[model samples]
Structure formats: structure tokens, C-alpha cells
Target: MELTWLELFIIVLASFRLTRLLVYDQITQFIRSPFFDEVEEEDEFGQKETYLVPKNRGIRGFFGQLLSCHWCTGVWCAIFICALFFVYYSIAFPLLLVLAVAGLASIIEVIVQKWLED
Candidate 1:
């Protein structure tokens, strides 16, 4: 479907939020997995740290895989974004815009860091 500038902007913002939430949000906390383990991990800024991560198992491991992948999350997020827009565009519009901008800033930060490193 053809989208106006505003709709396109909303989709961009909402997509950012969707990608971020499914990958980094607290929703993953509620999922218990047999392969869950915590290990030392370095922060993006180069600080040493640790975090819990889940290992992919058999075919049943799809949920874990989905939760761990931002791209995969993005697809689901896109679907939700559209649904939210259709259901309540007024409220969803600003909310997604704010969250999506935050997500975009994060991406820019990483890109800038990589550029500096290179």
C-alpha cells in the first residue's frame, strides 16, 4: 500500500521500537530456558560485564532464537506496528516516533563508534 510521508515516518519509528523491544526488552526475562547461562560480556563501550544468554536447541528453540534476534524481532515488530497504527494511530503515532528515534540514535552511535575505530 502507498504510504504518505507521515505514515512512512511512523513505520520507520515503529519498526525501530519493534526491533529493539523483541531483542533487548524485559519480555525475554519471563522466558525460562534449559540452556540459559550467564557469562562475562564486554559492553559496547568496552567495559567488561556479564549477561545471561540462551542457547538455541532443537526445533522447539524457535522462541529463544526469535527473542535473541533483532532482525527477526523487527518482522514481528513491523506487523504489530501496522496493527497498532490501524487500531489507534493517534496514540501509537507519537509513542512509536519517540521510541523509534531512540533506537535510531543508538544505531547512529554504533556507526560513529565504528567509524572512529576505523
Candidate 2:
């Protein structure tokens, strides 16, 4: 089926938002490592950064790796969202629409904050 520009945009935005939520939000905290801690990291620019990461353990470390990388989780999220959109087009569109709006707003918020910082 053909998608309108807005619909396409919504799909992209929803995928992005869902990926971030699953990877970073407190709602999925249970799946994250409880013992993980944030440590100071330095970038190429020498700017100090911090990130909370779990220690890697082979075989059992799949979930930790999955939840940490947006590219990995985003692929799954996009597939699920797209399947839901196709299977329940009429029922899911409104919810997807709302998520798209929220996602766009959040992205704009981030860009604005970055601009203001500079």
C-alpha cells in the first residue's frame, strides 16, 4: 500500500521513538543490568562523557548487547511496528500518529537544545 508523506514520516519517527524508549527508558529497567554503573568517558574532542553499561559476559550477554545498541533494537522495533501497522491498519494508525507527533517534537527539542547550547 502506498503511504502518504506524513504517514511515512510518522513511521520513521515512531520507529526512532520506540527504539529510544526500549533502549533507554525506565520501563525496561528490569532487563538492564542492575550492577551496571556509569563511568566517565572521554571523546575525541576530550569532552568528558558518561554512560551506564553492563559488564559483558559471553553467551548470556545477548540481551545486554541488544538493549544497548539502537541499531539492533531499532530493527526489531521497526519490524514490530510495521507489522502492527499492516495487520491492524485502521486500529493502529491513530496510536502511531500520536507517537509520530511525539517523536517529531522530541527530535525538535533535542536540536533546539543543541543550538541553544552553542
Candidate 3:
């Protein structure tokens, strides 16, 4: 198998989507669980308020963080693919394929976000 940037990008994108479809909902439930929520103060006045701080469960955040997630996944996938490219030829090809799937997933996520906004 030949390692190529395009292939890697496709793999990552696909992984991202699969992760979201297959895993995000369950993870989101866990994240939104009462345990994940915490109270915080706005100022020294001791005004307390509850906030939902999302847990970092990798692809679980899928559509959770919106554009930020898309960008983060995209950038991260690209970097990892590049690194793998320089690592091992055998692993590089497979890794690139995975990264490519993830990359495609990110693109789809971005598109969905835009549609939602409209």
C-alpha cells in the first residue's frame, strides 16, 4: 500500500463520522450526565451558577463544539497524517487512509453546521 496525503485525509474524515454516528450519542449522554456538570462563580461576589463543561472524549464531541470541533479535528488529523507519512511506509498507508476518513468527516460536520445555522 502506498501512503498518500489524499488517502490519509479520507480515512480520518471517515473515522470522524463513524465515531460520531456510532459513539457520540452515548458519549454525549455521559458528558451531559449530572456528574459532568459543575457549579462555578462569575465574580468574587460569590454569585454561583451552573455550567455544562463538555468532557474531552475525542470524537465523541462530534457536533458538540460546532466549528471549533471541526477545525480542531481537521488540524489534528492533518498533523497526525503528516507525522505518519514520515514514520513508516507500511503503517503510513493505512494511517493515511484512516486520516482521510476523519478529514471527510470533518468536512461533513462543517457542512452540517452551516445548514443548521440557516
Q: Which candidate has the highest TM-score of all?
A: 2
Q: lDDT tens string, model 3, 6-114?
A: 6555655645653453334454455335324354758677777776554455653443453234455455545655566567657666655664556575778889999
Tens-place lDDT per residue, model 1, 1-118, is: 4669977776877688667665666765555344355679788899989766666577436666776677887888888888887788888878778877877787889899999999
Compute the lDDT for candidate 1: 0.73
Question: What is candidate 2's lDDT per residue for 5-61, written digit by digit as tens?
Answer: 877788889898888888887887766755355689899999999887755676436
| Segments in model 1 whose C-alpha atoms lie over 4 Å from true places | 25-60
- Which has the greatest lDDT? 2
TM-score: the better of candidates 1 and 3: 1
Q: Rate the local accuracy (lDDT) of all candidates.
A: 0.73, 0.82, 0.54
Q: How many residue pairs clash in all the candidates, one count each?
A: 0, 0, 25
The positional error of residue 93 in candidate 3, measured at the CA in angstroms, is: 2.1
Candidate 2 segments exceeding 4 Å error: 31-60
Candidate 2: clashing pairs of residues? none
Residue 111: error of model 1 in Å? 2.3
